[model samples]
Structures are given as structure tokens and as C-alpha cells.
Target chain A: MMSKFITLLPEELHASLQNKYNEGFIYLLDITAVDYSEYPQAKEEAYALVYIIRHKSFQEHILIKTYLHTLEIETVTDIFKGANWLEREVYDQYGITFLHHPNLRRILNHHQFVGHPLRKSYPITKGQLSYEVDDLIDEMNNRLLSKNVVCRLESGSFSECNKDLMFLNLGPSHPASHGTIRTYVALDGETVEAAVSEIGYLHRGFEKSCENHSYNQIVPYTDRLNYCSAISNNIAYVKTVEEMLGITLPLRAQAIRVMLLELSRIEDHVVCLAAVLVDMGGLTNYWYMYNPREDIYELLSKLTGARLTNSYMRVGGMTNDLYEGFEEDLKDVIKKVQYGVEETLSLIKHNRIFHDRTQNVGVINAQDALNASMTGPNLRASGVPFDMRKDTPYYGYENYTFDVIVGSVGDVYDRVMVRFGEIQESIKIIEQVMQNLPEGEVNIKDAAITLPHKEAVYNTIEGVMNHFKLTYEGVKVPAGEYYSSLEATNGELGFFIVSDGSGIPYKVKVKAPSFTAMSAYPDIIEGSQLADAILTLGSLNIIAGEMDR
Target chain B: MEINTQTLPLETAITTRLDDAIGWARESSLWPMIFGTACCAIEFMSAAASKYDISRFGAEVVRFSPRQADLLIVAGTITYKQAPILKQIYDQMSEPKWVISMGACACSGGFYDNYSTMQGIDEIIPVDLYVGGCPPRPEALLDALLSLQKDLRTHTYNPDRHKDFKGLLDDV
Candidate 1:
């Protein structure tokens, strides 16, 4: 289906959104701002707001575009609560203000940071004066005090009540928090009365960097996002570029890509499950799962050079063909992973303490979860069966037979169960791919896009010239914009690229799943105890690299 | 109750140096702070796991609190927003602390040479060891730990060492 872009005036945004909401576009996927100041065409406005909305029932998606002549624009947070962080992120990067946004503050950068980084004029390597802990703490205290959002506790004694009600800073360094998310949790006794999560500690300016790097150079950077499943990020990014280039993969390449993606899914699930179990005091479970994780890493290392940051995918294909004995090694490792999954299930699935800690904890209902634009196992755990692989088939995923695991109660337990079930399904998919592994060259034969084989480059002069040109000039993508997404282990990892017919992308908006999922933290952990909050956060599997990026 | 070394037989003396004994004791038990920031943290976890067990090196205890930790494995990227927290954690740790800048990001910002990432964590905190890799393998981290242990065993601590040492603030 073609995407219809409706350019509305700032005043007409609300009504347009209301109309779209009535037309089955109920879910707002992403909100990003693009600066078209330097472009030759599209000179009508300096900054354009791009919104990606999806229909759950009809499975139809559309891109809503509106130019902002002024810095201010109407907010859609009233219509979609998930727009809270997305709009803040847009404001933070582009200096575009949302008029009616409740907490219209910086989401991915320090409040003291000056100038919008995503603007075409902003330098990529410019560093700001770092804030001291005292400065940040004072700033937080001021914000809390001005908002008057602190809650009071009612104990027998006034002094006891006052002491019981206090703000506790959870992270930016705390181990329980998977990444560098600093949350200001106002606690009444042990219960979290209110929590406001502050991100951007690990923000490396990914979008800004994408503007500087060429199409191929950005592949390595994509590995840094959701490093747990670097291959998935690599594939998702390369797939987006390929879509813009109108390149199709060979059957062998497609099969290899499916295997790698499934392998990454298993690795990500194992880490998520093991981390959650460890946070809940199940240290043995962490050991049980890490063994298989290491094996998977070894398998990945055998295929690609690196283990964690496997920049394995190229523009039109992969970096290398599957190594000899890869299938045998994969079969052996899959068996070990299956055993590890079973062992973990037997250990924690029926354990009394595991249920006590996870069950009924961080219960986010289906409507709230969808409102937050939650994806991956987190969304499925909330009883919404939305898997991008099943919904939008890619890489010949429609040929595979697997179940989309769903949970009735979206609690910590449900999240863990869904991950466990997905891991099993991934193993099954990998097995199926191995049974029907295709035969052909991994990289496409396009001299302009794909790299020539090393043997050809060494032997032939023409091959040498092509390789030099491809490396130096990079793949020239046609001038266009495309939104490509894949069912990443976390959720829907989307890459929206606006190409100017040049090597470098004009705008690269990464709709990180962890970023959206972590936005729901405050709502999920509001009335939960501190211990339960930690467990729930662990269950969410918020990776700071992707969240901040 | 003790006999003089000169007067006692050569076989019975068995004398040992004080510095050697102290270094051995200190190097034998290096409690690392569990301060992992990004991808390298995963490799760090794998190093702590069963396969590539770090307990054998006497660096197994991954303490969450900065006060109790002696070694800071600065894994992953340290952004401008996180640089202060890293310094605060390093300052909170008691004296005789060591740091291992794991991964390319912590070593020299890796590929993220943008506004948010710090060029290297060494700019904020003094790193004793630097491990190179995008996210260095578990084996690389273990090697860094062993080398740090070797330095602790061999090098003598001098009060004047701090005088020649310069930090990122000097450039700032």
C-alpha cells in the first residue's frame, strides 16, 4: 500500500489526527521532525513534522507530514499518550515546541544543553559543558518542587510520615536498572508513589551521526543499538536501505538472514530472561542461561568476526557467506539452547518465589499498553498479538511456521513467559531454516552496491576498480523516503530514511523499541513496591544504548 | 621467640619482602564495581559467568556499591551526561582503586564521536588498564584484569606518582 502524506497547517493538526483516528489509524508509531533547510526541493518550510500512524484492525499505515513555519505546533499527547516521549524527543533534537504537551522537556539530552543538534547547521562533534551531580540533583529538586508533584505519607508520627515520604533516585548507575536511566521515584514507605524517568545518559546522537556517515558507514553504528541483538539491528537497517534502493536479496541470502535474525532473537531472549531472573535473586538461572548465550555468541563469532557488535550485513547482502561446518555447529548449539530453555522453564516457571515476585507485579492493561505504543513481548504480554514478522512479512518470513506467543495478564510473569515461548519458537524456526538451507552466493552481483569478492578484487583489474569506487563513493540511493521495520527481538525496530539522492542520509529516524517501552515505566511502577519496580524494569529489558540512541 | 636471620641456618630463614606480601594479598582479592554502561557490559557479564569464570582470578565479587569496590571496569560508552556520575563513583570508592576501560567506546569513544559521547572515560576518571574492541571479548577483559593484577604485584606505590599524573580537567 502507498503512503499518503497529508500536509496540514499547525492549527489543523488536531482535526486531521481526529479524522485519522476515526479512519482506523488508532496507533501512533512514531513522531519525528526533519529539517529541510539544506534540501533543494521541499523548500516550502524549514522544519517538517513526520508522524507514522498504524491501524491495528485494518493493518493499514500512513505517514502524516506537516511543516512548522514557526517553532511551535499543536500537541497530540491528548490523543495519544505515547506521543509524550516522542514529541519531547522531537523538541529536544529539533528545538520544535509542542504547545499543549504536559511535560515538554528534553527527553534525550540534558536540559542545560544548548542548540538543537539535529538541525543541519549543528556540528556533529560539538560537546557541551557536562553537568555535575550537585547541579543535576538541584535541577531535579527544582523541577519537582515547581511541579509540586511530591506525595505525603500518613504514618502514626509526623516525623515518621515525613521520613517515609521521600524521593529516591534509582539509576543512571544503579545495577538493577539495566541501563543508564535515572528515575526520580517518590516513595511512600517502600511503595513508589510517583516516578519520572530521565533518559539520555547514553545518548550518542545516532540520528545526527547518521547525517554525517554514508549509507554503508552507518551499518556499524546500527550494531550499537540494541547490542544484545546486533544482527537484528544490522538487518533492519540494511533492509531499509535496500528498500530505498529497490534491491531484492537472493534466496540463499534471505535464508541466511532469517537464520541470523532468529539466532539473535534467541540471544536477546536469553539475556532478557537471565537478567530478569538475576534481578529477582535467581542467580542460578542467570548462570543456566548465560551458557547458551555464550554458545550463541560463539556461533555468531564463527559467522562474523565480532560477537557483540556484529556488523554482518552489507547494503544488498551480508558481509560473508556461511562458513563451512556452520550448519553442524548451529545444530549442536541449538540443542544446547533448547536444553537451557527447558532447564530455565523448569526452574522458574513453577517456583513459588518467582511467581510471588513477578505475578500481579507491574500489571499494565491492554488498552494502556497499546496507548503507550508498547511492542515486542511487552505488547504481546498485554494480550495484543501484534508481531511485525507476522503482520508485515519480510525476508520470506511468511514461509516459516511459528506461533505468536501472547499472555493474558501483562505482568512481569507474562513478559518472561512470552520471552521464553518466543525463544522456543525461534529455535524451531532456526531448525526449519537449517532443514531447507538454500545454495547460492550470499552477496548480490551488483557492482555498484555490493562489494566484489576478495578473490575477484585481487585477480581482476575491473573488479579492483569497482571495489574502489564502491568503497569510496558508497551506494547511491535514489532520492526518496521509506519506513522499513522488522520484528526485532524487542519489538518493531523501524528505520525511517530520507535520502537526498546522495550517499549520506538527509534524515535517519530510528524508532527504537526500548525507547517506547521504557516510556511506560512511570505508569507501570506507580503503586508498586521498590523491589517489584526493579523486577518490572528488568522484565521490560530496556537497553540504554537503543533507548538513548 | 624469633631467631635472627643471620644467626639462623640458611634453610630455616625463609625471609619474604613486605611489599611482595602486601601486593600479593591486595592483588589476590580485587572486588570489581559492577558499573557496566552498554554493550561491553554484556561481555563483562559473560566473563563473570560460568564458562569464562572470573572467580579464578580472585576478581569475582561484582559489588554494586562503589564504597566496597576496588576495581572499576568501565565497560561500554560513557556519555557527557554520565561522565560526572563516573567520576562520583570513582571518588566514592576508597583509596587504592584501579580502573579498566573496557571496549573501544570507554577506551576512545569507539565509533560514537558525537556530541553526547565522551571521547574516552579516561578524560573523567584515570584508567589503570585499557582493553580495545568495539565490545571487547570476555577473554580480553579477563586478560586486562590479569595484567592489572600483575602490575599490582610488581609495581611499587609512590606518593610522588600523583604529582606527575594529569587528568582531563587540565585540558579543559
Candidate 2:
């Protein structure tokens, strides 16, 4: 449905990607593939790799498709550094070999995992064992050799290389890791000489689940992807499906979506800042942050039935109309959260210890951040003023008046500061949504797309069948593919859906933000102190549910 | 029934069966090691935070290391890749420990019955209690701890014996 859907041969995949990068299409949005082996419609090619790249401002967007004869293709990591993880993931799922890929082993699955699960030929429920810890020492030694630092590890000998330098496991269960990521760091006294981050501990096969589930059933899955802000993920998933269907939602539904979206963004920022502050040893600010999140959660629980995973967004529109006096509750919570944030942050924002731990410790410039495909608050903190809401302008975001907040320094402090500013701007957008509240039915007018009312269901056979089919099978989307992204809490939360003119999607590739952000961890953490590395990871806000999905 | 014999632990002298006294002591101060891996982690924090206040029930000393913890609260989804680590943690915990499998995923892989996901965390490590929800609410998690506490109140001391439980496939 988007522009520039050109097909290329595997031989030209590398060169074409290079040519695009040379022409200022530097922002590599995503690299995903669909296994056509299992599509309902017969296809010539077994697989088609889709590349989404954009210029700096995201004005001239390009989505290229390349068919593969075999499960082998040239790796594009040289042109786009962000292609490293994306390529590895493709290799992991589709078993497509990325030639010259730096570390192209299993990423989402353990090495013990046998077959590529994403391929249609592969069985869905064939479980595997997850033994064997990853070998990060070889890579650590390689980096140390490049640095000319004395390599403590000599032929796998644990001969007390140096008392000062040691290997430490920072997570997967540690307090600072927020219980998900495992960072293996070779430490030189207090400084980290090399680090290798191992994720996928929470890879619960979210995309594979999408392959079997209906469009509506996947909403709860999206909520788990970014649990901090469930609605944003919900919006991204539904927006992609709605785009494929070519349906325009009612004005009131759009307004309500924007309202919940901004509220979710504020909640996400609050949680990220709270966790980051906790990592920085500012424990008091956590309650200050969490209290506001609880308020938002309470508000959402009333609107939707669930708290953390609110499956509130239907494909065509919202599930329910806004309750009466909802506007008053929204405004009151916004005021309370704003005041709470300002009052609590003021205590530690200017504190010397906080500044010392965060400032200039994990510095990343704009170019490097963009090259790594970072987005949202982290990329903005690196001084890029790119926002999907402003540039792509989805769901009537253009009408809202809010600045794209940027920071000069790309460190923990700047990331925190950017989140703080963005929270205020989100509040501003929510206020705007309140001002432009239109009165109308929330669900669309079409009966086939949306379920009929209870009264209608009880009275007519058509309504009864409609309710039954719609409830169980979900709305059928046309046979086409669309890549839709939105500015989620962490970054660009993208969903690339390949529909087969049925309820079940052919392939759903989530270009999750935390995955890319966490991929850039080793690059920025090597030269920093051990303490700063923890703060840097927390600042990135790598939700394992999203990253490992 | 008296839970603690005295305000100061050293000066306490109480007459009771070894099992009853030890069980009361174990249930009263359950040091929980949270193996949090997904959305359920957030709920665990809420339960641990100011609102739910998990410390009120004595399982609030959140420890990451298994050796120091008396209870293993497996709080989220345990995938195939993460199952070994979960088993290692469960194996490394101090003796007389209990495992509270939290969330639907931890109990039975929830909605994701896929290639990479373990059918349930109990497939790798034995479980004492299972709480069900996509992500069980904070209250549900608290109630799980309380329910585990009721079970813990009858724990008998055994130096050479472990819980008589085995996984479906424990080799991994």
C-alpha cells in the first residue's frame, strides 16, 4: 500500500541497499521477510525480503522487496550498521543466510533450537530445549585485542589473568537489569573493556502467534510487547490492519485514540524515567513516577477492562464510547501527574551525584544513533528532531501543536531530560484532544466490520450471525501488505502485516524499538564505567517483551 | 498462636514441634527471589511498590541471588532459551524453598504455544503454586504469595530431602 514497493534479485540486494544509503536514504527503518511457501496464493519465490529505508527527515520513504531463490543473501550490515541485528533475526527465523554477517547465530532462539520456526514448513508447537550459555568470551577477547588491552583470557585458561580485570554477568535477573537482559562485560577495574548483551530470554514467539491468531486476537500480544504503554502498541497494530482494509475511522474514535495514546506516552515516559532514576540510585523518584502510572492505569482500567494489557482498540474503531464525565477524570489525573513529576524531579534533577552518574558517560552522537536505527526519546536525546507524529502525521497528529523535544547530549541524563520534556508535550497533546472532543458514535457505521449491538443481536438472525462470525473469526482484511509505524514510548513501534484475504495474517513482522536500541548496547557501553553502563541500559529502556518478541 | 517467641530473636525460648516452629519462621520471613522475565515483572513491582505493599506479608525482601532467597517467585513467561536459567536458579536456591509460578505464561505458556516457548515453566522446574492470568493482577500475585505461605506454614525440615516433584522433561 505504501510507495516504492520494487522487487529486486538476491544478487542486487546488497548493491541496491548500498545505492539507497549513498543517496541519503540513511535511516534503515527495518529489514523483514515473508515466507511465501505457506501463502494461500501460489507464488514463484519462496521468500521475499522487504527493506524499509527513509531519508533523514523521513520525507522520501522507500520500501523495497527482494525475492530469494535460496536461503542465502548478501548481508547489508556494511551500508546500514543497524542491519546487523535485523539480518541476524532474519537468519534466525527464516534460516536465510546473511553472508559476511558478523554474528549470525540464533538471536531470538537459543542455539539448542533446531529449526527455523517462521517458515511455513516448520511446525508451530514443536518445542525445543534451551541449554548451553552463549560464548561471549571469544568476542570479548577479540574486542580487547583490537584495543591492545592485555587480554586476560589465554586459550580458555582461567589463570587469574589480572586481579584488576574480571568478567561479570550484569543481568537477566539483576536489579538494574529490570529482570530481563543479561550483559556479559569484561571489566578492567571499574571500567568496562568489552560487553556482550544476550537477550531473547523473553522471546515467547509473539510474531509466530500472530501467524495463527486473528487480527483482533493479536491486540493482547501487542500490549505485552510494550507493557509500559499498552495503548500505543494497540494503536500501531490496529492502524496497520485498518490501513490494509482502507477504512477511515470516525472522528470521535480518532479523537479518543489520540487521547489514550498521549496518556499512554506520558505513562511510558513516567515508568522509563522511574526505572532509570532507580538505576541511578534516586529511589524516591520511583514512587513519584509509579504513583502517576498507577493513576493512569486506574483510568485505563475503567475505560478498558484490563490494566496492563488493555485490548481496547478494535480494527475499525474503539470497542466502547467514552463514559460520561470521563473528560473530568482525564484532566484531573493529567494535572496530578504533571505536578507530581515536576515536584519530585526538582529534588534530584540538579543533584550533583545524579549529574555525575549520567552526564557524558554513555555519549552517542546523532549520526551513530541514527545509523543504529534508534528512535523515539533515545534518538531525540542524541539531537535528531525526527518524530513519526510530526513527519508521517497519523491519526490527526498534524493538528496538534507540540514541539519535538531534542537534547544536545546523548547520555543517560539527556535521555531522562528528553523523556521529561516529551511527557509535558504529551500532556499538551492530550489537552488539545480534550479541546477538540467531537460528539458522535465511536464505532464505525459499517455492520460487517463492527459487531452489532446487544439489542440488534437479540432481535435479528443477521445480527446473531454477524456477532458470532465477528466475535470468533474477526474482520477479514484484503490480500495485501502494509508497514505502519508510530512513535511509541521507546521509539518507532512498527508492524508489517502480510494479509492473505483472510482473518489470519500471512506474516507479521514487528520492528520493535527495544530490539534495535538494545542491539546498540555493546557499541556505547565498552568505554564507560560499569556503573554508567547499567545507567545507560536503563536509559535505553530495553523492554525484553518487545525486544525478544 | 504466637508467630515469634520474643521481640529479640536470640533471647526467644518457645516450646513447639520442630516442624511447626520452623514452618512458622519460614512462612513469616520469606525472602523471595523474583525470576521476572516479562509483563508480570511490572505487576510484581506494583505489588512490591507503595500501593500493594508486599512487605506487609513478610515476602518483601526481594533478592536476585538464589542462594540467599528462601522462595523462588517465577514471575513471567519462561521460554525455551530461558528455561535452563530458571532451572539453575531453582536448583541453586536454599533448601526448604518454595516456587510460586506466577502468570498464565509461567503456569502453562499462556496464549503462546509455539516452537521457542516452553509449554510451561514447570516443564523445567517443579512448581509449588500456579497463579493464572495473562498477567495476574497485583492482588492475585499477593494472594499467590499468601497461598504459598499457607503451604509454607507446614514445611518440615529435611536436610537430605528435596520436594518430591519432577518436571515433564527436566534434562534441559
Query: What local distance difference test score does each model get?
Result: 0.86, 0.85
lDDT of 2 at B45: 84
Docking class of 2: medium
Model 2 misses residue A238 by how many Å?
Answer: 0.4
lDDT of 2: 0.85
Write model 2 residue lDDT over B6-35, tens digit each, in one string: 565886666788788778878889999998
Please, what is the TM-score per model? 0.94, 0.95
lDDT of 2 by residue, A1-549 (tens): 433487888898789888888888999989988899768888869898999998976766788998888888889898889999899888889888999887777788887777898989888898887576676777666666666565445586443345367889987778889657988988878989878888888888888989889898888888998888889899999988888888888888998998888899898888888888888777888888888788888888898988899989988887798887888989889987998798777977788998888889798899999999998889999999989888889889999999999999898889989999989999999999999888888888776688899998999998899899987887888888888888888888988889888888888989899888988989899888998898998898888888998
Proportion of native contacts kept per candidate: 0.77, 0.79
Instruction: Report the C-alpha lDDT of model 1 over A458-543, residue by residue, as the tens digit.
Output: 99999899989888878989887778789999998989999888878889999999988999998899888999999999999998
Which candidate should be chosen as best, given TM-score against the real structure?
A: 2
Each predicted complex: what DockQ? 0.64, 0.68
Sliding window of 10 residues with minimal summed lDDT for model 2 chain A: A154-163
